[model samples]
Target: MSRTEATGIRTVLSERLLQFAADRALQTREFERRVAALPADSPARASMGATLSAAKAWEAGLLWVAWRLQPRSRIGA
Candidate 1:
């Protein structure tokens, strides 16, 4: 996350963002590991890309949901 994102008082979904990032990273690492072990002519290359795309999409959806649930802070309360 950027400095503003981490330090903002506007982080209403910080926890969900953090978890989503962690999960995405892990999935990426696992995908890389498996892809590296696959043969050059393997038919699973397409599958690997599909799985990675799905993981990314899922993470994005979670972020969207969290954003909708985000709280707004009022000034001079």
Candidate 2:
């Protein structure tokens, strides 16, 4: 109910959101590497590509939610 508690909760949520975004980015990078190392005709490469696309989509969604949750004053800066 207190302003301090509300800010604390927001901070924690922001940190967790950032962490999730970072983790997804890392996973996407790894998937790209795996896809690159696979043969051109490999079915697994196609699967990895799809996985990477999904990871990027998830990251974008998280970023959008985080942006919406941020304070108005902090949104543009």
Candidate 3:
């Protein structure tokens, strides 16, 4: 593949990853809202909170990978 083609594909993949990460963040927020409604000391609340932490971590990793996939500017372009 040509350089242009490779760059285009990377751009598309990066955009999709960003979109996915945004969607995941929204879902995580909703989960947090629901979890907050549960009694603070409820076992289910604790369990779901743990799951929420995992979701947040996954989202962060996705964002990091997407950022890495983005095209970098040339120093003297």
Candidate 4:
């Protein structure tokens, strides 16, 4: 691939990854808020906890993908 094309691809992928990370952060915050408002004895709290953990794992996977896509050095330097 040409240097220009490779740089463009990396830029696009990085931007998309940033957006995905931000969205996941918002979702996690909202989930925590909902879980906290639940009573101590509420059965739903347990399920929400599991969901939060899964969301975190998903985010970590996305980060790994982003790391792999990033340019290791100046693309054309």
Per-candidate local distance difference test:
0.72, 0.80, 0.93, 0.85
Q: Give model 1's TM-score versus the native structure.
A: 0.56
- Poorest lDDT segment (10 consecutive residues) of candidate 3: 38-47
> 1 or 3, which is superior by TM-score?
3
lDDT for each residue of candidate 4 in 1-77, tens digit (9 for 90 to 100): 99889988997897799788879878888888989999999988898899888988888888788777877676787
Residue lDDT tens for model 1, 1-77: 87566546346466667677678878787877888788978898878878878887777777776575555566995
Candidate 4 is scored at a TM of 0.82
Worst 10 residues of 2 by lDDT: 68-77
Question: Which RMSD does model 1 reach against the true structure?
Answer: 7.8
Better model by TM-score: candidate 1 vs candidate 2: 2
Expressed as tens digits, the lDDT of each residue in 31-67 for candidate 3 is: 8999999887898987897899999999999999999
Query: Model 2: how far is 25 from its true place, Å?
Result: 0.9
Highest lDDT, which number? Answer: 3
- Window of ten residues with lowest summed lDDT in model 4: 66-75
Higher-scoring candidate on lDDT, 1 or 3: 3
Write the number of the candidate with greater lDDT, choosing between 1 and 4. Answer: 4
Better of 2 and 3 by lDDT: 3
Pull out the clashing pairs in model 4.
Answer: none
